[model samples]
Target: MERIAIAVFITGASGLIAQVVLLRELLTIFQGNELSVGIILSNWLILEAVGSYIGGKGVEKIRKRVEFFYSFSLFFSLSLVAGIYAVRLGRLLLKSLPGEGVGIGGMLLLSFLV
Candidate 1:
């Protein structure tokens, strides 16, 4: 249906935008190393796949599918903003000075957490 198509398009567009914004924020946190790109992207893909799997499995239990879908979409958008905020705050939590590189282990942990 036309509504489904539009929803899908908006979801995809918003997801891509969030990914880019997160990547940029993460690159700054990790000191912009080339390896950070691979780590960030791989972690992102893995998390997305896991979330999709979990959502797919749980979706059938919902009685009000349309309302649930819209609510989940809103939650996703809000979570993206929260995620970016978290990434920015992580530097202070980790006690790292600005422009300093987080080592591989720290980068992995931070990326996975975020």
Candidate 2:
């Protein structure tokens, strides 16, 4: 009921915010390269599908655990914030890695983390 509706709203809003953050971070990391954007978006879609499938498989087991859902949502929101910070600081942190910026593999890994 109302709880479920609130959960749904929070989930949707957080997901949208995360998407925007992820894209902006990728663009910054990749220097606005169209190819990089495509790669990140494609990988994002595939990974999201995989995640949804995995979550679906576990839904029944957690059906009675509303608290679990709430906790997971909270953790997810926190992770989004942390992930954004990590990506923002990536260049400085990885500055000694010897590159103008992170490579494709690094970018993919960062995108996956986000």
Candidate 3:
């Protein structure tokens, strides 16, 4: 297979897996509430938009560093897996109080990190 095809497959697989893990984690954290789902989706789109904007502005500069991009992408995928584990453990460690859920600031931070 071509290198580009391999890269695309890896990227797609990582993204889909992360999305499933994140959605499951968020649903658990938010007690499976529908509004929480919306919040997660909105946060995802917002962050994605920001990434797109930044990538658009720096595409030329980024193209010059393909090796760096590949390295970073590898690290990112590894981190996502670790992050999923951490989130699962964190949910157990940091149990939500009655009538409490993830706040806006926490959601924003989670969205930014994830």
Candidate 4:
């Protein structure tokens, strides 16, 4: 009970922190445009909802609940690190010069992919 509550709180806090960190990285990649902020946020929300729906359905099938939870938490943390790296790498892959803004198509593609 209390342990679960604390775990939930930590998970939520870490998630929010990850979002902010990702947003900052994305803004740097996209040259800090206002539209980039909206696009990043929209994509984040949509993906989160979809992931929640899929995970919710799949979670019931797992027998080792505690192990699964811990494993998933670690995976989530690693994913955030990878996501940030991908966003930074995207700038180079897209061939955009430093401080140059990414176009809408590039932004959308990178945001969705990351």
Candidate 5:
């Protein structure tokens, strides 16, 4: 569960950073302004709220039924795998030095893998 939460936060932060840069460019691309930026962020927050609520409700049922021992063991394994792969891929991509497409794909894929 901690793995899932960390994955969610890491991926969300990565995406949010990219979104910030992309959104800044829209004023030039579409002749938009700060008002458009505000709207976009508002929309993002609104969707995030809906997603968080739905996820919480969905997980509540599973949380009640699944034994903590099994569930946590599984989550621990997944976190181990995710942490190892993320480190390996991150190092590999870094050595490549600003090349290849290993960027967000690796992180995003780890979320799915776990």
Candidate 6:
């Protein structure tokens, strides 16, 4: 299980890096706004929690090789891809919006994605 642990660690670390970078950029872009920023960040935190819970259960149900490291790697990759794509698409959708609603939509979608 050492290999599985390491793979999951690396994948999770890389994902955190991506998430932090984008969020920091967004914070910079909206430095003066507190409420909107809170909403944006809370969305991620809540969704990640949901993702982890769902993924943990879902991961167990999928039987893999005795060496389950492969499963970890695949799960990591797919989640990363989905997150990146969702952020990109959500950004476009939010950019054209009038206020905080589009961001709320992004958060909601992210919740289900979890």
Candidate lDDT values, in order: 0.87, 0.79, 0.73, 0.90, 0.50, 0.60
Tens digits of per-residue lDDT, candidate 2, 1-114, equal 997998789899988989898789768877778777887898889998998999889888875578887798888889888988988877665562433766777777667766
Q: How far is candidate 2 from the true structure (C-alpha RMSD, Å)?
A: 2.6
Question: Tens digit of lDDT per residue, candidate 1, span 1-114?
Answer: 999899989998998898889889999898887899889888878998999999889988999988887998999889998999999898987888976778887788788988
Give a tens-digit lDDT track for model 6, residues 6-100: 86688779877866755664544334267546766777787779878987887767666445766656776787666656655654655645343
Can you tell me which runs of candidate 6 are displaced by over 4 Å? 28-32, 65-92, 95-114
Task: Tell me how candidate 6 scores on lDDT.
Answer: 0.60
Over 4 Å off, model 1: none
- TM per candidate comes to 0.91, 0.79, 0.73, 0.93, 0.39, 0.53
Candidate maximizing lDDT: 4
What stretches of model 5 exceed 4 Å from their correct place? 1-9, 61-114
Worst ten-residue run, lDDT, model 6?
105-114
RMSD of each: 1.3, 2.6, 3.2, 1.1, 11.6, 4.6
Ranking by lDDT: 4, 1, 2, 3, 6, 5
lDDT of 5: 0.50
lDDT of 1 at 103: 82
Candidate 4, position 14, lDDT:
98
What local lDDT does model 6 show for residue 27? 47
Candidate 4, 1-114: lDDT as tens digits? 999899989999998999889888889888887899989888888998999999899988999998987998999999998999999899888889986778998999899988
Evaluated at residue 10, the lDDT of candidate 6 is 81
Clash-forming residue pairs, model 2? none
Worst 10 residues of 3 by lDDT: 90-99
Candidate 3, 1-114: lDDT as tens digits: 597788878888978888988889867766777776777788888888998999789877765566876887888888888877766665444555645786666655554555
Clashing pairs in 4: none
**Where is model 2 more than 4 Å wrong at Cα?**
92-102
